[model samples]
Target: MHTGLHFISGLPRSGSALLAALLRQNPDVHAGITSPIGSLISMLLREMSQGNESAIFIDDTQRKAILRGVFDGYYGAISQTQTVFDTNRLWCAKLNVVAALFPNAKVVCCVRHLPWVLDSIERLTQQNRWELSKIFNFDPGGTVYSRVEGLVSSSGLVGFAYNALKQAMHSEESDRLLLVSYETLTREPQRALDAIYDFTGLPPFQHDFESVTLDANEFDARLGTPGLHKVGNAVRPNERQSILPPDLWRRFEVDSFWSEPAWNLRGVRIV
Candidate 1:
């Protein structure tokens, strides 16, 4: 069955996985950890572009239809009553494509402080000391400085998403975007969820903050970074000292553009 489609995207180590777990509490909502649908869409676009010799054979109408079918076919098995919220970090960069395909769909971006985001990833890396992380291409060895540098490189995981999110905030379709802060979500989940419900035009449902749970153990295991997506059985802030050195922390502090109101030129909603 087919129904409205929304998206969950934002920085890594943010509350996206937690948000998906909570959103799933509402029977009408269907969401999960990041899916390959975004990558699939990207691949399809590249294949249809001039990079492929067969591109000349496909018209814009056909291209649009094919892209739309990706969503339909991906969630085609879900019940018609459910509103699908696909999770992917690439959606922020593809807002124009999404706007054309599903004008009403809103993108909920979960964000966190840049330093803490890096700290979270570092924590996971340290915990899995026995295994090399797929994040760094399993490169065997490097100091925290090198790792932090790699992460903030333009094409790196955090860097690309950060840039894409900034792009979305200033986009003409900014009204269709919502930023969910990790602090706000952990300290005031109900408030964040209320804003999300209003933005997506979905009826509110009570979520058990004390019983939230999501197990992506296998997924993280495959990535060689266990607990990467594990948010525990409860939705609460886990306060701790930043493992990041003060120098490194300060270096990336300025990268958190979402913290500044002036950067939000299009008035993208933040919760």
Candidate 2:
């Protein structure tokens, strides 16, 4: 019995893996660490575009059907009654294709403060001081200004996802989107889980918050990050000081754009 598909997306280092880990506790849901389906979405879109597969007799309707099959075929391995959630930072950018292919699908964006997100990355870099991370392409030459510019620039990682999220929040499918904040997700997990269960319409499972843990070393290593997705074995308040210089951190803390009054007007719910 096939159920439906939703997405776990938004900024990296913002609890996407933690959400997937907790959701997996529900036997009825098939959620996991970031999946490659988003990349596949882009790949298929290019393959099916006008100058490509369209010239080979494949039409738009057939293309849409085939694209839908990709989800079915990929997650078809999960058992009956299980909901599918493919995690990726790229899904926020692919929401249009998602709304078209799986009209009922929702994208649950994992969000955190931009300054803290950058601080988290910096902490990891310092902890692994002996080695350079692929996150910065192993280049450690830049000053704080340049490094930040790389992240907030239009083509940068966070910039791109933030733009994509803003687009989805204003879209006609805004009702299908949910923003899950990291602070609430880790602090008051029961409330967070309840909200997630209601949003995705999945049967609730008794999650063991005290013993929650996920190991992503093998996968993280592939991306040149060892503990990028690591979380405490328990869901509890995580308090830590920023290792970044005060001035550097202040530059990115200027705004909490996602929670501003303007988005409320668009009817996108933030919890």
Candidate 3:
């Protein structure tokens, strides 16, 4: 069987982890959190392997180090499984790079409402030690800066990331890609899981769907509040309660260039 790679990407606080956790329930799938740095390294390595002079050169150990560096202390240690699922929120725009490396890789882009995404990001910034500004490289003035600045200033980077992913889905290879909304997943997890299983060709596992909800509170608590040790350090609650006031939400506009009507299409509901 060919080993498959599934990229579970989305805006921060958009339930990438939740989706990963649900997919991890399948015995045939090894889904875990990864980072953009890993995607970059993989792309570079792939390019070099293809005899592309524009790519950088590094020894085997050095190459492994680069990959490992992106995942904190767990570099190059990813188990060789039949199917590896990388659930990284930062892999939103970077998917293009990853696609170049693994042309056959399957992508699952998760999305959430723009207003809620911004609200969640704002809350996370105030409550957690993590800095969204630094992560997204936001700036008030600068060409590249404006791209993400608009998101941070209004709906937050989550919206920007969602838009980027949508654009990526338009590629000729998009049929191999799956776009999953966070709301749909939450409302009907089993149905979502079933779709995922079909997409990845994984045999069903005899696990309770409710088991995926094990850390519901701990996960919710991290949004805007302090992190709980039990649920792992990664999860956080929304700090701002709401990202947009009623007036702001009304005034906030979705750029025509960034809208994806395909996302509005109703698909299978996994309720």
Point to the candidate with the largest TM-score: 1
In the range 14-117, model 1's lDDT, one tens digit per residue, is 99999999999888888999998998999999999999999999999999999998887878868477899999999999999989999888999999999999
Q: How does each model score on lDDT?
A: 0.91, 0.80, 0.54
- lDDT value for candidate 3? 0.54
Per-residue lDDT, model 1, residue 111, is: 96
In model 1, the Cα lDDT at residue 116 comes to 94
Model 2 collision count: 0
Per-candidate TM vs. native?
0.98, 0.93, 0.62
Candidates by lDDT, descending order: 1, 2, 3
Model 3, C-alpha of 31: deviation from truth (Å)? 1.6
lDDT of 2 by residue, 36-65 (tens): 777787888788777584547887898888
